[model samples]
Target: MSSNSTPYYFVPGLSRHPVMASIGLLGFGSGMTGLVNGYSWGAPLTIASVVYVLFVLYKWFGDAISESNSGQNSINVDVSYRWSMSWFIFSEIMFFAAFFSALFYARSISMPWLGDIESKLLWPTFTAVWPNDGPAGLVEQFSTMGPWPIPTINTLLLLSSGVTVTWAHHAIRENNQKHAVWGLAATVFLGAIFLGFQVYEYIHAYRDLNLKLTSGVYGSTFFMLTGFHGFHVFLGALMLAVVLRRAIRGDFTADNHFAFEGASWYWHFVDVVWLGLYVVIYWM
Candidate 1:
């Protein structure tokens, strides 16, 4: 094939990766269901399935990387990848929307209805508050987390990481490998620090504040939002680390760096979601 000429679309041959991935996911799902139902080997099975899934992804994507590096990927292939990634992100947005909607319904509708005039006639002492001790005192009288020190610090860390990732992207565009590497390293470090603070915050919530996943509506929403977001942060950090590895190996150039760009997009999406969490979950 010519180095720079119009060419036929690239079509990858069928492989066993997809079947292996599906099997891994099935095992993971089965394990999760078993764990929820109190099976003895659930957790270990889940871990194993997770490891298998990761292995499959590494192998599958490694092939794609090899194809791209070999100049086998055409313009159509690049566009297809972009479209696929965009749709994937859109799906994620919808996932979070469902959770946020649940939070709204609980706080705005369910709580109010529970404490309404008719409800008071039935319960006699229930009060309608945003973060009350929940109906029948089922939830403990615990304090909610505020957007202070730890959360604020985490916010800063994520924001700074966003900036650093952007710097890395810019550096890559300019073909400044040294600056790009440093920027990616900084982003990874900041993401790790953010995760560390999150763990400490969770400990504080459980031990000091008496807040937990089972602590009623407030606790449930709190954990669901922040916990899922933390998981995303972890995934995003992992994606960045992979990109960094590729960069160190001189895989990206000014013209072909969608791997870096895709990871950056996911990281920025993560940052924005955290900002929303800070405002709605912590500050409000």
Candidate 2:
């Protein structure tokens, strides 16, 4: 392609980013394994690996952004990005589906089976309750998490963020930079607040309610679902923040704004996952 003409497809040159990223991940995995096995250098290795990963991501993303800004990304590239994101979100759905299925099995299948007459004969005092501490009473006594102030508030916050992110997408399409920035900012703010409330909820669960990870099936499922969701929210918010920065810098135009759209898609996916969690984990 000529310097003045857009390429049919932008194929980046072979780079060291993939190798560096793999090394960083390997180090992180090794560090985590060491930490679990009580190795002395685990903490330092983990921290260093995290820093290395972040640095590599920074450089890698910067290069991609530069390519986009230079008009190297064609329409074909945009379509590929959309399809890639769609498949990525579909995989995330499956990830959560596995967790939800575990919850279902524990609640609807295994519990009832254990409560049956045949199983009950083995342990006369055991009751197969939803939040039971196991037949042997191995888990600690704990209260269940309810859909109250914090959880309900978080649900509302995520729902509202969905709206705000959609509004930002509309604003971007209309070439209204100011409104887009504001909308993205509001979405990020709401996500941050939701995370803050989640932290408080976890603290309350541990300190007051005594609902911990060791509280048997209920506690483990609840924490696994909500904790993973919270992590996704953090990532979604971070992506929105980056998109917001780009918006403020007037990077996107009415014709081209896939970065903004991609971030919004992820944020919306996070919102949808939270809704499912609220219904299944909290209400059910």
Each model's TM-score, in the order given?
A: 0.94, 0.92
lDDT of 1 by residue, 180-258 (tens): 9999999999999999999999999999999988889899899989998998998899889989999999989888888
Clashes of each: 0, 0
**Top TM-score: which candidate number?**
1
CA-lDDT, candidates in order: 0.90, 0.89
lDDT (Cα, tens digit) per residue for candidate 2, span 163-184: 9999999999999999999999
Worst 10 residues of 2 by lDDT: 1-10
TM-score of 1: 0.94
